[model samples]
Target: MTEGETPAQVGASSVDIKDVDVIAPNFKKRLSGVTSTIVQLVPYQMKLGIRIATLGPGLPAYLPHIRWTGLFGLWRPPVGRRHRIWHARRNNEMLAGLILKYVLSMPLKLIFTSAAQRHHSSYTRWLIRRMDAVAATNSRSGGFLQVEHTVIRHGVDLDLFHPPQAQDDTIAATGLPGTLLVGCFGRVRHQKGTDLFVKAMIELLPQYPDWTAVISGRITPENKGFADSLKAGIAKAGLERRIVFLGEVDDIRPWYRRLDLYVAPSRNEGFGLTPLEAMASQTAVVASDAGAYAEMIVEGETGACVPAGDYGALRDAICTYLAAPSLAALHGKAGLRHARDTFALENEARSLNRLYEALIG
Candidate 1:
C-alpha cells in the first residue's frame, strides 16, 4: 500500500495466484480495478516446471523458478501509484500476470504478450508507454500499440488444424469439396459482432453463389439469450439457408477443415484466435480492423481485415475474396508461413526461457 493510497481497488481480482484453473471470483470481487480470468492450464504448472528444470537447470535460468510464487506473495501492486488499476482480459497468459506488478516496479527488460488488448481507459492508455517491449501476437496487434515490440503471431497446431489430407478429396458429409464454406468460431456475443457478421452475409449471399457461413462457439448459460438473439437475427436475415450454427465442440478440427474462410467481427480484442485457427486450417480470413487485425492481415496478402461494425466494409471484404478462391488460398498459405516463422511453441518457449533467466538474474 502506498502512502495516502486507499486499499486495493474493489472487485480487483487476486494477483497472488498464477494457476489459471483455480482463479477465484472473490479475487476480482476484492479488487475493483482487477479483471479475473481462468486460462485452464495452471494445475500443470509445477509439473511443467520440473520437466523444464530436468531438461537442464538452464531451462529455468531465464524463466521464473517454479516456486517463485511463495517468495513474491500474491497480488502485489504498486507502492505509490495512488490509484493502481487493472484491465484484465486473458485467454492464455495468466502466469505472466503473477509477475506484472513486480515487473512494473523494476527496470528489467520484458516481453509483454497479449499486447493487443482493446481499451480506451486513460490509465491503460498511459501504461502502454511505460512498457519496455510488446509481444504482439499478430501484426494488427503491433500496429494498434503504436510501438513495435516483437511480432510473435499467435500459434496453432498446424498438423491438427488442417484440411483433409487430400485437398481435392471429397468430404461429402461436409459438402466442402465442391461448395465454398466460410466458418466463424469463438464466443457468440454481441460484442463479437455476431449480428454484424450475419448482416454482412445476408447482404452478400445474393451476389455470391456456392458460399455459406458456419459459426461455432459456446453460448454462456447466462447468455443463452445472446445465442437465441443470433438465431433470430439469422432467421430475420433470411440466412437460415446460408448460415449454420455448430454450437461448441470439444475438438474443432472437423469444423476447421470444412471451411474456405474464417471471419471474426469482434468489436474489440487483444488478438482473436479463431482466425488464426482458420489460417492454420489453410483457410483464408476476413476479420475486423480492431485489435491485431492490422498486424496479422496484410490487406491483400494474408487475409482481409476490415473495420468493426461497418457492415458495408465487412460485406465487401467477404465478397471480394469469395469471388476469387485463389486469392483466399494465397492468403491462407501466407498466414501459415507467418505462424510457423514466429509464433511456433518452440519460439515462444525459447523467448520465455530467456525472459525467466533474466528475471532471476
Candidate 2:
C-alpha cells in the first residue's frame, strides 16, 4: 500500500494528505484537456519526488491521488512544509482553493493555470487576483490576464506519440482506405469546426483519390444531430468510404502515428495540444489559427495554419499538401524535430515543478 491507500480504496496510489507537498485538483467529472493533463502530469511529478497528488475524479487508476475526504485533513500543513500548494486548472477548482484557504483557513497556497484565450469575466478576474501564482499556457493567454503570469506552453509525450515504427502496417491495420491519411480528432461540434473539415475533405479528396480523411472523436448527445448532418453531407458527396469516423478511440497515439497529416480545425480552443501531439508523432499538421496553434506550427516549415472558420482558406491550405505529398513528408520530419526540442511532456512537468518549488519554498 502507498502512503494513504486503505484496504477499501482498490485502484490508484492514495498519498497521505500530511505528506503531500502539492495538491493538483481535477474537479471535472468529464474527460477534458485539463483532466487529461492532470492524469499525464501527476505521475511524472510523483516520479520526480515532488509529492504531488491529484484530487477528484476522471483520472486513471495508477496515478498518485487523494480521496475527496482528504479535504478534511487540509487544515494542517503537510509534514516538512509550511503550506501545501493547491494547483487548479479551472475556475471551479480555483474557487474551491479560495474557499479552502480563505474560508476554511487551510494551510494552502493557491495557484491557478489559465489556458483560456478570451477576456476574463468579472468573477474570473476577481478569483485570479487572489491566487498566489499564475501560469498561462501561451503568450496570448498571458496577454488576456490582468495579473502577471508565467507563460508555459503545453507539450506532448514524445515517447507515447512518435514516428510510426511501421507506417504501412499501422495504416493497414486500421483498414481505412487510401495510401495517405488526413485526420481531425476531437469532439464533433460547430465550434470545433468539424463541418469545415468535412467540407474541405469533400472538395479535396475526390481529386486526390489516394488520400483518405479520418475524423476520430466523440459526438456528444447534444451534438448528435450536428454530426448526423455532416455524415449526410459526406454521403451526398459520395465520399462515405473515403472519409471515416472512428469514434472515441481508446488510445489515440497509434492513430496519430498512422497519419501523414493532422488537422485541428477548431474555431476556438483553450491552448490546443493536438497539433503538438501530431507534430510529436511525425505528422504534418494544417491547423486553424485557434488557441496556440499559430505559435506551434512554423507556417510552411512544419505545417500550415489557416484562419479559423474560413472554409476557403482551410480548403486551400489542405490542398497545398495534397498537391505534393513530398512536402508533407518533409514538414512531418521537421515537425518531429520541433516537437522533440520544444514540446516534450517532460519539459512541461519540469517547468511546472520549478513553479511548484518556488511556491512551496
Query: How would you encode candidate 2's per-residue C-alpha lDDT over 187-286 as one tens digit per residue?
Result: 9999899999999999999899989999999999999999999999999999999999889988788888888889999999999889998998889999
RMSD of 1: 11.4
Give lDDT: candidate 2, residue 96: 96
Residue-level lDDT for 84 in candidate 2: 93
Show how many residue pairs clash in every candidate, following the order shown.
27, 0
lDDT of 1 at 265: 87
Candidate 2 residue-wise lDDT at 320: 92
Q: After superposition, how far is residue 307 of candidate 2 from its true place, in Å?
A: 1.4
Report how far off residue 41 is in candidate 1 (Å): 9.5
| Tens-digit lDDT string for candidate 1 (166-210) | 554223566532377777777788878887877777777767767
* TM-score of each prediction: 0.63, 0.95
